[model samples]
Target: MSATDKKQKQAVIAGAGPAGLTGAYELLKHTDIHPVVFEESGEIGGISRTVRYHGNRMDIGGHRFFSKSQRVTDWWDEIMPLQGAPSLDDKLLHTTDKTFAANGPDPEQCDRVMLVRNRISRIFYLHKFFDYPISLKWQTFANMGLVRTIEAGCGYLWSVFFKKPETSLENFYINRFGKPLYRMFFEDYTEKVWGVHPSKLGADWGAQRVKGLSIFAILKDMLKKSFSKKENIKEVETSLIEQFVYPKLGPGQLWETVADEVRQRGGEVITETPVKEIHVENNRVTSVTVENAQGERREVPCDYLLSSLPLKDLVQSIRGIEVPDEVKRIAGDLPYRDFITVGLLMKRLTIDNQTRIKTFANRIPDTWIYIQERDVRIGRLQVFNNWSPYLVKNYENTVWIGLEYFCTEGDAFWQMDDRAFIDMAVGELAKIGIIDPADVLDSVRIKVKKAYPSYFGSYYELDRVKEFLNGIENLWCIGRNGQHRYNNMDHSMMTAMVAVDHIAAGNTDKSAVWSVNTEEEYHESK
Candidate 1:
C-alpha cells in the first residue's frame, strides 16, 4: 500500500458523551483536523439525555450545570447559546430575597445562564425538618447520647486538627460528620448506589465532592448561619461558593446544542453506531469496527481515535489483539453499577416548594429517598422538575421523579419489564412517603447501563487497562468510562480538550489524557 492507498486524514470518537464530542469539536476548531463520531444510542446525550414522559421532558436524572472554567462555559454558552436560548413564556423561577441575602453579587458570574434564562434557585427552611449538615447539634438528640456524639466529635476534631490523615471515604467522613451523621446522610444512599458499604469505598471521590469539609466547617457554618439566619445571610455569584448555572430546559439541552454545532461545523456525528471492535496491527489502532442497531459491522480507519467508550468494553472488543493477561484481568475486575430511571409524570399544577430542590439537601421530597427501606437495591431518585422549569409540559404542571436502581445486565431489576419496574418504584417510593401513586399521571423508563463508573480500590488495575490502550498508537481515552475514573462531567470534558490539543500536536498518549481530570486552566483562544 503506497500513498495512493493511504486513508484520508480523520479522527474517530466512540461515544457521544461530553468528552467524545468535545474532543471532536476542539480538534475541528483548533486544528486542521476532521472527525467522525459514533455513538451507541440513537439519541445524542448519554447520561445527560432528555426523555419524555406523558408529554413532559426530563433529564436522565437531575443534572445541574455549574463549571468554573471559562473554556467550558465558552463552548457551552456558544452552543447552548444560553445568552438567548429558547425559554418558557412564563419564567419558572421564584426569587427569595431572604434566601439570596448576599449584600452584593459579582453581576458577571450571575449574569449569563440564569439571568437570560430567567431561572432562579435559593434555599428554603422546610418545617425545620432536618439539620443543615449532619452535626453534633442534632445527633446528640436524634438517637446517640451526648457521650457518643462527644466522643465522635472529639475523634473528628483530633483527626483533622491533629492532621491525622484519612485514606478512605469512610474514614474521612467518619472523622468529620461522626459515624451517625455519615450513616444518616451518605451511608445508605451510597450503599444503594454502589452496592457496597461506605467503608469499602475510597475517600477520593468523597474528598473531591465534599473534601476539606470538616466537623469544624459544618459546625462553624451551622453556628454562623444560625446567628446570620436570624439576621439572614446568603451568597450569590457564579463562583463555586455561590450560584450554579442551570439550563432552562433539562441539562441535555446543552449537549443537544453542542451536537448541532458539531454538525454545522462539518463534523459527522453517527449516533446508534456502537463500536464493535478496534482492529490493531503492530501495536497501532489501525481501524475501528462498528455495528448499527441492525448489526451490520464495518471498519472505519482514521488518523487518530479518541474513545469515550467503557474501558472494559473497549478492551473486550479488540480483534487480532495480543494484550497481556494481567491487563485483561485488571479490566475484568473493574466493576460498575448501571442505572435506570423510572420517570413518573404527575398531575400536579405545581409541586410544593418546587425551587427548594436545588441543593442536595434532605427533606422537601427533593431529597434522594434511599431505597434501603425495601428489599430493592435501587439507588436514589432525582426529581427532574427540580433541575429546570422548562421540563414541565404546560399549565397542567408536573413532577418528574427519577427512581434509580442499580443493576447488572440480566439481574432482577435489569430484567424487569418496564411496567413491572415502574410499578415497583411507585410502590417502594410511596412506602417512603416521598410520592403518592394517585398523583402520577403517566411514566417512562430509561435504562442506562454503565452510567456511574465505580471506584472499587482498583486504580492499579485501571492503570493496567490504561497500559493496554497506551500500546495502541493514535488512540486516547477520555471521560468516566473511557478512563474508569469517577470524574464529574466537567472534568471529563476537560480531558477531551487536552486530548485534542495533543492530537493537534501530532502526539497520542493515553496516560496524558487520563491525567486531565483536575486541571482548571481555561483554553485560551489562539
Candidate 2:
C-alpha cells in the first residue's frame, strides 16, 4: 500500500495518570499512532494529584521523585528542568548542599521547575524519634532504652544464626531485623496500614516495598559513609537515599504540563470521561465505550488499548471475550487499601526541631514521619513545607501538614463525615503529642479509593488473570492499579515505556511489561 493510502492508527488510553500519560506521550514521540486519553475525574494525576485548598496544596500520599532508572530521571528533566537558582526557603536559609543546574529556570520566578529536596524521614515510636531504618546511633539507643537495646542486639544475633523460612511478612521481618526490633518498630505500624496482621500477609509485600532493608544493610551504609566521602559513596538503597527531586508546585504540576504538551501535539486528553466498556473481537481490543459526566456514552474505535484502570474494573469492563471463571473470581476478590489524607494548616507545630538540619522557622525537618504509636490511627505524617516551600502558600508563617489514614472503602472510618474525620485526625495528633489541637487554623480532607493494592485476598492467583488478559493482543496494562502490584511511581512509568516499546517493535509478548519490578537483583542493586 502507498504511504498516503495507509490508514492512521489510533491508540486509546484509559486513566490520565502517570502510566496512561506516559504511554500517550511515548506513542506520539516515537510512532505515527494518534492517541486519545480519557480520565474519570477532572484532575490530571491519579493518586499523585495535588489538591489545592485555600492557597495551600496537598500531595496526597507524599510522592518523592527519586528513581534508580536514568530514563525516568531524564524524562522528568525533559518535562520540567531542575532549578538553577535556590528556592524561597533555600535562598532564605542559605542551604548549601542542594544541587542546582547551571542555567536552568529559577523556581522563584518560574512556576514550571523542579527543586532538589533533602530527604529526612523518621519513625515516631514511644513518643520519641528514631531513624527510619533503625539507625545505629547513641540517640537511637537512648530512645530505645538500654534493656531494649540489649534485647534487640540479642535478637538480631539470634536471627542471623537461625533464619526462618520467609513464608509470611512477619517471618520476613523477623529474619531481617530480629523479632524484638520488628515488634517494636514495624509490627504495629504495618498492621495499621494494611488492616491485617503481618503473619497473614504474603512475603512478597516485604520483598517489593522493603527490599534489602535490614539491620545489616544499615550498618554497612553507616560504615561506608563513615569511611568514604559522602559524594563518593554510590549504590545506596532506595530507603537510604538522602536527596530527591520534586516539582515546584507538586507532582500534579508535572502531569498537567505533560497533558498540555500532549494536546499541543495533536493528541486528545478528555477529562471527566471514563472508559466504561472494552469491545474485543478475535482476541483483540477493537473499541472502547466511554461515558462523560452528563451520562452520555459513546463507543470509539481504536487499534490499540492502553489501560491504567484498576484490575477489577478492567476485568469487569471487557465484552465479547470468554473470561475464565477462575480469572473472574480472582479479579473480583482482589483486595485494595483505601487512603485518606487530612491537610491541616497550623500556625506552628508543637514539636521541637530536634535535628541539626536548618529550616525556615526552626521546624522539624521531616518530609515524612511514620507513626508507630499504637494509640493513634494515623499511619504517616507529611510536612509539606519540607517537601517544597512552594507546596505551602504561607511557607514562613503557617505549617501545612498531611495526616494519612488507611482503611477499607465503605467502612466506618471511610463513611465518617468530613468535619468529624478532620476532628478525629486533629485529636489523634494531639493525643500523640505531635500537635496541639487548639493551634489548628484550618483543615481539609481528601479520600482515595484503591490507593494501595494488597498482596492478600486472591492476589496469589492473579497470574491466571494476567494470562487471560495477555491473550488480547491489542490490550496492555501498565501502572500500579493496572498490574495490581504495589509499584512506585517510576516502576509504573517503566511499565508503560516497555509496553510502548513492544507496540513500536510489533512484539506482542507481554512478559517484559510484567517483569518491571519483579526481578530480585534488579531491585537489590539499585
* Candidate models: Cα lDDT each: 0.64, 0.89
Give each model's clash number. 1, 0
lDDT of 2 by residue, 1-526 (tens): 8997999999999999889999999999999999999999999988888888987888989898887778888899999998888565576445432343122223346568788887889999999999887799999999999999999999999999999999999999999999999999989998998999999899998999888789888998888888976643237877887888898888999999999999999899999999999999999999999999999999999999999999999999999978888888999999999999999999999998988887755789998999999889999999998887777766656889999999999999999999999999999999988899989999999999999999997999999999999999999999999999998888888899999999999999999999999865322111
Each prediction's RMSD over C-alphas, in Å, is 7.2, 3.4
- Candidate 1, residues 58-143, lDDT tens digits: the string is 66745556555667766777665554543331233333233332232222233225323212322111112233234444433444
What's the lDDT for candidate 2?
0.89
* TM-scores of the candidates in the order shown: 0.80, 0.96
Give candidate 2 misplaced runs (Cα > 4 Å): 93-109, 231-234, 521-526
Candidate 1: which pairs clash?
169-203
What's model 2's lDDT at 423?
Answer: 95
lDDT of candidate 2 at residue 297, scale 0 to 100: 99
